[model samples]
Target: MDLMAMIENAMTSPVIYLAILALATLDAFLPFLPSESVVIAAAVFAVSGIPSLPLIIVLAALGAFVGDHIGYLIGRLLRERRPGGRLIRAADRIAPHLHRRGGALIIAGRFVPGGRTAIVTASGATGYPLTRFTFFTAIAAVTWAGYSGLIGYLGGVAFESNSSLGLVVGLGLALSITALGELVRYVSRRRAAATGAG
Candidate 1:
């Protein structure tokens, strides 16, 4: 079945929420799954009163956190094995920038497609302290869940009210997230350059 149809089916069942959470967590490590659609669909269901919004948000965040931590652990393991493992070596070019604007990079990474995995992996490879990593990771997960959920909820609201408005809003939210990712990258690069020069 197509994505929308799959989402619709899942939404109709009680297992949809759990599945979404699991998928999102796995997506963090795998980096190829469609976690965004799952979250969006859950939000749509929540807005339609099929599930509670708070629960949706909480579960989504939990899943994201779990996935991120798993990725981090993998990185840590690699680091422990070799100071300059494959993961660290690949991320080295951006490590300096990531370290400088760590918080912003983490947050922006959550919004960027395929970024969640990269951030978590990079965080691990960089040897960011566990405490600091968890703190910033939570922030990123919450922001991602909130932004995606809100957009999906708004889409549901528009579906109930006006289709045109819902379409516009959904598109706008997607575009804004993409733009924010670009901005974050730009800022990080500039910061890294300055730090290197100094």
Candidate 2:
């Protein structure tokens, strides 16, 4: 079988759920992996009722939650090792802001491509409260999973006649959303900087 055929077969198989869980979990620290793409693809296939949509959302959220903690732990470990490390220094500089608006940053960063890892890791490095981090990260994971899955589900519904086209639409929508988010963040930062200068 060709690559696409093999992937389709796996998506239809019972193991697809496990695959989703694994990919989402790994993608937290390893942003290079295409966990979002996997989730989107599975969601696209879910329109046919092979893999359950609810299960996809739940597993994806759970995986993300677990993976986010791993990033936090890594940051904590790094902080313990190197008091003079650049990451620790950066975390120190942002510690006050993190305490004030950490939850918002944690939640928003989850949706950003690599922002999730950096923010969560910095949170840990800065010794942000565990309870607060857990609470916000939970929200982030669930919302992120829901948003991604829903986008794919919508694309699938729109292009039910063509699954391939549905996948393309889903991916395109995901990319567009990510890009929009980055644009907003950029604009917000620039405005904040300008205001600070003035």
Give the C-alpha miss distance for residue 26 in model 1, angstroms: 0.9
Task: For candidate 1, write residues 10-43 as lDDT tens digits.
Answer: 7757787788789779988887786766666666
Q: In model 1, which range of ten residues has the least summed lDDT?
A: 160-169
Any residue pairs clashing in model 2, and if so which? Answer: none
Candidate 1's C-alpha runs over 4 A off are 1-7, 161-172, 183-198
Please, what is the whole-model Cα lDDT of each candidate in the order they appear? 0.77, 0.89
Per-model TM-score, in order, reads: 0.79, 0.95
State the lDDT of candidate 2 residue by residue for 16-82, as single tens digits.
8898898888887898888788889899989999778899999999999998898888889989999
How does model 2 score by TM-score?
Answer: 0.95
lDDT value, candidate 2, whole model: 0.89
